[model samples]
Target: MANYINPMEPEIKYNIALLYFNEGRDEDAIKILKECIKLKDNIIKYHRTLGVVYLTNGKHDEGIKEVRTAFKLNENDILTLNNAGCYYAIYTNDLHRAYYNLKKAADGITSNTDEYTKNVIKKNYNDIKLVINKIEKGKPNDSIKVPDLRLLY
Candidate 1:
């Protein structure tokens, strides 16, 4: 069997990737995520996050591939579905993929959590739901007159 390192080491690398991402250095973020992948090959979060970084940098196909790989590791992840949907909607403009992911996200069951598991509830889920509602209901005719609710949160 391969030797095991502390999982936290790879987690730290993942955090560094997020820092680089926030600094607007997408290339650096990708590098750190890749390193994290080698260290913790089974960590799906690293793959998904790296895919998002790629998407932000306009590497749509690569981003989709990476996120899909992550999903293969964990098929029940709502975040991955949302990320894939956003990539399809915003980057590829592939309404079909967007619809599929958004539908999955909207219908997926989530665990109920108490105080100790508070991380279960996040706004991203809500955001995806809103987008799905928009698509299903059709856009407002006066799009410009509508509020930019995206910045609301």
Candidate 2:
């Protein structure tokens, strides 16, 4: 007998990983997502999911690196920009870069963006605006946490 593989196998695995992630099975999701990346490293969604998994699982640096890789692969990708913004804002406390990337993503929204994604970008942009306002007022925003960008997926 010959082994058979479906071209959509990676996508299938990616979706399964997503289900696992949403169910709070981070380790299982991570494993499947890593396998998906190994199969199709160019898919930004896989990297994004994996990066979020790493970040939420206390592997901040690794998560940032993976998200950065996705950004490098496609800077104009709304999802990548959103993730980059959230990562910088939340983990690194780099408000400037966060605002820039988030603003870019919000402004770059086109017809290709689904209504849900457009809404997510808008909400994130508004959230960042509030943060910027608070920062400008010398108000401590240490209590404000970045919204999970993964939820937009």
Candidate 3:
């Protein structure tokens, strides 16, 4: 509703993009993502969310590329890693990358010891562990530990 670009605070630009996305306005989200790039080009979240926007719009390749860059920047980002992995695993059906990212997510969650965090991880961990068993069982061919972040978000 207001101007997407703030005069300062580069991170807010990303939030604006997210607000656009949460509002179900993909075009506005794209515009804000581009603006975020202009303000601070190195933020991985902007690209990650941009990828999500593109993916939601059915531009899977563009989404994958952008989200992959985000993954490169932050391997532990549940959003980018899981999204890219799922795109590769389910959509494109690239089992290796899918297993890698999903495992990374599952492992990352397990690595945190806080009870609250563990409980949080426990839920998704259980789901992702299913995928892990698939990968460890000498088969990336299964869809078990798919790393769904819908619950996390």
- Best candidate according to TM-score: 2
Residue 97 displacement in candidate 2 (angstroms): 0.9
The 10-residue segment of model 2 with minimum total lDDT is 144-153
List, in order, the clash count of every candidate structure. Answer: 0, 0, 2
Q: Report the lDDT tens digits of candidate 1 across residue range 1-153.
A: 898766459877788788988899889999999999998788888888888888767787888888889889988676677677667666665656765775675456456433321222234345545555676677656232111111100
Each model's lDDT comes to 0.67, 0.83, 0.68
Model 3 TM-score (2 dp)? 0.68
Q: Count steric clashes of candidate 3.
A: 2
TM-score to true structure, per model: 0.67, 0.84, 0.68
Write the residue-wise lDDT of candidate 2 on 15-86 in tens digits. 899999999999999999999989989988888879988988889988988888888788888877887888
Off by over 4 Å in 2: 1-8, 139-151
lDDT of 2 at 145: 56
* Candidate 3 lDDT score at position 91: 70
Worst 10 residues of 1 by lDDT: 144-153
Instruction: Flag regions of model 1 displaced more than 4 Å.
Output: 1-8, 109-153
Pick the winner on lDDT between candidates 1 and 3: 3
* C-alpha RMSD in Å of predicted model 2 compared with the true structure: 3.5
Model 3 whole-model lDDT (C-alpha atoms):
0.68
Highest lDDT scorer: 2
